[model samples]
Target: MSWLPNADIALLKKRAVIIQKMRRFFIQRDLLEVETPSLSQAGVTDQHLFCFKTHFVGPEISERKPDPLGVPLYLQTSPEFHMKRLLSAGSGSIFQIAKAFRNEESGRYHNPEFTLLEWYRVGFDHFQLMDEMEQLLKLVLACDNATRLTYQQAFQLHLDVDPLSASLEQLKVAGASLDLGDVLDNEDDKDTVLQLLFCVAIEPVIANDAPCFVYNFPASQAALARISKDDNRVAERFEVYYKGIELANGFHELSDSKEQRLRFEKDNRLRQKNNLPQMPIDHRFVDSLDSLPDCSGVALGIDRLIMLATGQSHIDNVVSFTIKGA
Candidate 1:
């Protein structure tokens, strides 16, 4: 019936155990647990992400109280912006297991609303952060040491193509083998092509027996990560995969406010081209970057982790309710 939870009692208990293990892992490292507001005046600028918007109505005043329509607010896609504000305020090395919402499709591995385990490590590069991520995954999943690869290496191994240097023609040729049809025909974004190839051809074939970390992504796809000093063509971004499931995404954070603003503007431009609504940039977050320390941050999917830990097949099995159930 509608009154019952989507997940069983045993799966619910297992989820609790997994979260406890995660908290213990962070606490031992001296990372403070913090919380940020779930709703905010501004939303993320990433064109790929969609936010759930709402309006806050205050107590009834006169018929005219300036703008009486109330202020538009958005449910956060992640706690990244607010948590970075805490770091700018001198909170060293913090973590949060927060409820994140996204307006997106739901399936075996996704829910519109889910729990995310996100953390920031001061004085850590993406590599160092990967080291910590490896330790935590081993402890929580009881899995073996993870294998590491560069984004280029992964594309080379799986598709026999270089993601960074491949021309649109070359990418389309490779994508042809996957029967992607016109998916890449009219698409001009190189990063979009690489992502389709990676998702359709590579992610499914990643090492499934244990965790595999693919790092040094193409610079164009570097969401908030810094471009690598050793290689200008790549950014210090990484993703953790296990059993064909993308478990986490991490970045060596970019600290330049100007560059961040440019990226935000670029995303809005892209949104305009694609007929999507432009998202308001979180200026407070941009303002905090001057004091933002050199660090690495990662966001892990808790429902997927629980699915792996408990041997459940779908996200619905681990979460209390899915969108339909809700």
Candidate 2:
């Protein structure tokens, strides 16, 4: 739209306008838009995240490929950890529109690369942030379908069980009866099992009549969110959904570096058990924990939001050029 030499005109215009709307929406709330470095001294440790590995030593290096003693560089999965660091550094409220990457994921709803709209707000807990998420969707789409449901409630209403308190034996039994859970078991991978159940059992039944937020996650699955005070059995996190598709994820961010480190360890252990590569910990980000405020943050998929706003279904429709086409 602005005479970009590389980007397509029509797609550029749409992306530009969408970004404009997003920035103005947040700006009205006095949230600061900021930038962050794409590369880091270390990489993400989340087992669910798969970073595209690379070598980034300067050209002056004697070794060209960064082999043998190469310094590992990677494409970021999300700007979340860095943005959280900013929160710790007294950045009261901030947002960043960043390009993120993940390896071996390509589908109608996914790409190897995509835009991530990550933001954080201090002084608000997870539910407060859920309210904020509703505001964002309402403002962005000019719609009021910010419905709320707990994970357990969603599961009970859809799958006829309480996910939080269900035993492994019970889950395996219950899951073996569902289309999504027939392959999952307590003897199998928990993440994969839960994900399979989610895909087949619960996620599809979300409020298609309106936008929805599913909250109160299991504590064992609490990626980086704190355990709920009302119920330590669950975490204070939520995922925003539209038309049965996941659009965003938010958390009452876990502030204790110790707890954060433990989660990272758990994730890596799972990854190792599954034969996935273990990533290095981001120490600088961990160091920022001392200065980080009590806050809640979210990362929303801009491509998916655009798809919903424009009534498109596939992510490639919103992307200017997809990995397959590129």
Q: TM-score of every model? A: 0.96, 0.90
**Which pairs of residues collide in model 2?**
88-291, 88-292
- Report the lDDT tens digits of candidate 2 across residue range 168-188: 666666677775433564346
Pick by TM-score: which candidate is best? Answer: 1
For candidate 1, write residues 34-149 as lDDT tens digits. Answer: 99999988898888899999877875432334344786789999999999999999999999999999998589998999999999999999999999999999988899999999
The Cα error of candidate 2 at residue 164, in Å, is 1.6
lDDT of 2 at 68: 57
